[model samples]
Target: MDEIPIFIAILSFIVMCIGEILAYYSISLKYRYEFEAISFGFIFGVATLILIPKSFFEGFEIFVVFGMIVVYLIEKYLAYCPLSRKYCIECDNLEEVIKIKFIYPISFFIHTFIDGLIIAVSYISNIGLPLYFAILLHKLPAGFVLMSPLKGVYKNPLYPGVIVSFGTVLGTVIGLITLKNISPKILLAFSGGIFLGAFLMLVPHIYEHKKEKSFLYLLIGYILVMVITLIQ
Candidate 1:
């Protein structure tokens, strides 16, 4: 059921975000906005893929982009698109559309397998608790923020959400395999990067919902992450 940890984990995220009063307040204030960086910093780290070919990294990078597309797909589901003429809003249209629009089962199986691998590795490594918390804290608002693009595409919301979830499985696989061998400094940096990206996704919501920003929630986010680290 995922009833136990799912809730606790979600609660932890709430607490963590609530706890950071300064950051929460900071987000609401004047100096609190960001523009999307239209670039990837090809960061040449210490101990890069000397043995691992450049092609492998290139392949994985392509896969990661593919996964993002899946995420975009799943995100469509989380948003309500009244203008969507794909299915009847009230009738059995949704079920019917879901049946026909769904791509090949075999394609999804391969996609899901990769996505599952990513989630499994990340969860097994215990970054999952924090990642889960991070995701829950941001998902609802993030969904709304994403509505802009989803509207542009004009598709059913549920379809994209499924795609995104499957993408996570793929990410978990790649993350797990490479993370272990990477330098400690790199791992720390990578984890921090993950947290940063999570926050980047959180920003638009924080801005849009400034009145609802909770300092305590931010504080709780920090404390809970620390606690999770201790447990791990």
Candidate 2:
């Protein structure tokens, strides 16, 4: 495993933790969410247009798209978990809602672990640095997305951040330790597909949640991703 990717992952994890903490404690709730929505669009657009294609040409194949679709469909089930009531219309009672919110963080733990594994596999193949930075930037919006919703449901800033950070660390360890063991073709293709699927899934969801979409933020995200690619 390359030290660069590992270092990047650790840094990304810390960035996310700090962002979550700020979001959890911040009093400007409205401004924060508005910013988050725009950030979401920007990240989604960038990932779809730049990161996904770059990843594919790096070696992920056409068949990997199918694998990604399949995995995404399966993962969608997690969205319906009781915790998802935060996004649902029919949810009632703070007590019941709070009971299930924990489920989201738990699932996030697993998701971040997979993210680490994907990073590990990619870096080992020598396609790691650019993808590593892409993935790292990807987490900033993700951290906001994860904590923003939970702000109302939980009191502690550390709660979600700690769980997410723990998950990231665990995944990084697994990825670093098992770097060479994973098959590059399958891991890269499949993981690449997964990343693409994630981007696709978020686009529609963002539009649905935000009736008035922020094209400016979306464009900024696109430009930022391009700049990151160009600089690298």
Candidate 3:
């Protein structure tokens, strides 16, 4: 029983790795693939809406709301440090994509760290299977999305996958070591808020620079999220 969460965490990491590799190879490097990127945004937005609210209703109201407000503000208004600025330049050219590639690993590292922390906390607390699977499902798409931009910039193809997967592993290690000390519900709620804020911030940016100049990718993202929902 104690080891189950660890096992699942490792499995999710593997899934993420596989997703990244497959995406790196399958996606064309000749063009910027906006669809996969927006799909990632959609998955994150819908999951946040569902999971955070669920945590809120289940009695983590204060934590959930606090998390939501804090993350929303931080992501929306305060996410502009030197590093962030370097990462957020418009992805308009190959040079921009290369800059973004350097930025991608940093953002993905933080994101996956949270993923590992939550996965460890949830399973350690014996949280329900439904939520467990929900978390797992997100990692699958994350790999694809994390690799999308890099596909155009790097020739090795495996570099982005390894970088993002390393983030997951790093997060998992930290979570396994520290998560036992935190209240699972509180931790989960806070993470959910962060996820919501982060993804919410990306939605508009994705639409603004959409390759097709349409919401087709965003719609596809919604459909993908819906499919994950149905799987649940």
Candidate 4:
């Protein structure tokens, strides 16, 4: 067989790609889900760093930026068909929501990059292969969870969304390169910055619609996922 880490590392991408399909199928399976799927993608970044060795942080940091682009593309597909100017019910008025209105169509791309790193880190972590496996198991759920938000933003099915998830390959390649030349302490500090950016961007979303039980739970899960990621 192939070298284990090398193999697992590469395999991670395949698992992620398959996950998107699995996620889409889940809706057909009829699970009650919120549109806030991108949130999981962000949390994945934080968790990836936490579980992996401190040394891998720099590699992880670079992977996140690239991965965000992947998420943006996915959102592009979801928003492309543009169904109703009316599905946006979360906000009190269109006037206030309009400022960030441009973001949803592509923001999901950012979310996936975070998710890619999260999956990558599990492979890198003290959680070991089993933890990695556990993470891969959630890939489908993640796909579906993420898809929910895009569905609401645009009634169109996610075509680019499928393409964007392919970024898992780019994410893995860059991360592997970082593995060869980065110092752990520096990486940790860098990771802190990345997570901070993602956290700041997402925290408000979680707080904005605090009324939804599912979203409230997602935030709790988000924080919990982050907490699990810190130095564990």
Candidate 5:
């Protein structure tokens, strides 16, 4: 319940917002392929290298799988019956619309909330600096990915950033207040599953435009994550 973790959480939220701002400006047709490719790679790396492994080590793999399946099913359902179908009837880009409106927001909220919780816990354990940097390394990309596809969905480009920031803040508050009584493994595993599902969903978009360059960017993104993990 110390104030240090709370302060670190606030800093993390600020870093994430910076990334979101950068992404908002980067959402253009010219860079769509590269953006998505990097996003896919980033998400993939996070799932395989970080989330999934942690879940397995903690013996919470089933929850990871369950989270993935839940995201997958929800995505499938949204494909046909989109949450904003009435408003977007004339829109041809149904997939992006669905993602921006539903999937990404849900996934980002859960994932970032977990990120905040982890930060709080790590700080409370007196091992927060390294973990904070690790989390910081990905926050930019995380924010970028969350904001990249949100152009047409929201009139105000800052909504996604606000949603993610709120989640992080909420998680931090909860972590600070109930650090002793709560077990985050299950939530961690489930969030990992959601990331995995979200990564799968990005596959098609990555290849939709610049096939060759997209693959290259994907590799770069994955390598960036790998490097981050190594440093940690």
Candidate 6:
């Protein structure tokens, strides 16, 4: 079975923690739009430069679409669910409140879990370094996104960070256990789809709210990713 190196695992965990810490301290409602725009750009760049190319070369393009559809449906469900409420809101029913509160944190956990799986699988497949870099590059923005909604809701903001971190560890373990059966290409494609779907969902709202500034930031974010890719 393929295994992630101890150092790599540790480094990934540290980077994720750093992102969470930064978000906990720095993210605010005032700059939420800008943050979302940059996040969209980062995910776009990752999809374009890393995930799509890798998946296309391996003939797994269909899985990308499937992944996107999955996220779209999931987002729709979250949006329209009767039990759904904003993170900071209070619901009269305890069960419904718990369910509503957990929606985003659960999603964050799943996403980061896949991230861990991808990192482990990619490393085993010999494409670890760049993919790892790409994943690491986005961790900060991802942390912000994860924390933004849950920041004031949770008395200890560390809760969501711990959830995501646990997800990553579990994913790495699962990847190691299933290494022989899974294909990295398909995983990459699916992850790309999720990223694209998320970008599509988020960037539009940001564009509507911030117009030109959002566009400029989005472009800057994408360019930053490209520059990093070239450097790598």
Runs of candidate 3 with Cα error greater than 4 angstroms are 27-62, 69-98, 202-232
- List per-prediction Cα lDDT, in the order shown: 0.34, 0.59, 0.59, 0.44, 0.64, 0.65
Candidate 1 structure, TM-score to reference: 0.39
Clashing pairs in 4: 35-149, 37-145, 55-184, 71-108, 71-109, 72-109
Which 10-residue window of candidate 1 scores lowest in summed lDDT? 38-47
After TM-score superposition, the amount by which residue 152's alpha carbon in candidate 3 deviates from its true location, in angstroms, is: 3.2
Descending-TM-score candidate ranking: 2, 6, 3, 5, 4, 1
TM-score of 4: 0.48
lDDT (tens digit, per residue) of candidate 5 on 1-232: 4677677777778877877788778643345456556756766776678766655555687888898897677555543224322112223555655555776577568667866776665555444454455456556655665666665688786876677666777887887777755555565566568767866765655555456677788787788778877887
Give TM per candidate.
Answer: 0.39, 0.71, 0.63, 0.48, 0.59, 0.70
Question: Which pairs clash (backbone N, Cα, C closer than 3 Å) in model 5?
Answer: none
Off by over 4 Å in 4: 1-107, 117-142, 145-158, 212-232
lDDT of 2 by residue, 20-88 (tens): 766566633344334544444444544455445545544466746775675465456555334332233
- lDDT, candidate 4, residue 187? 39
Top-scoring candidate (lDDT):
6
> What's the CA error at residue 17 for candidate 4, in Å?
6.4
lDDT, ranked from best to worst: 6, 5, 3, 2, 4, 1
Q: Give all candidate RMSDs, comma-separated.
A: 12.9, 4.5, 5.6, 8.0, 5.8, 4.9
| Candidate 3 structure, TM-score to reference | 0.63
The residue pairs that clash in candidate 6, if any, are none
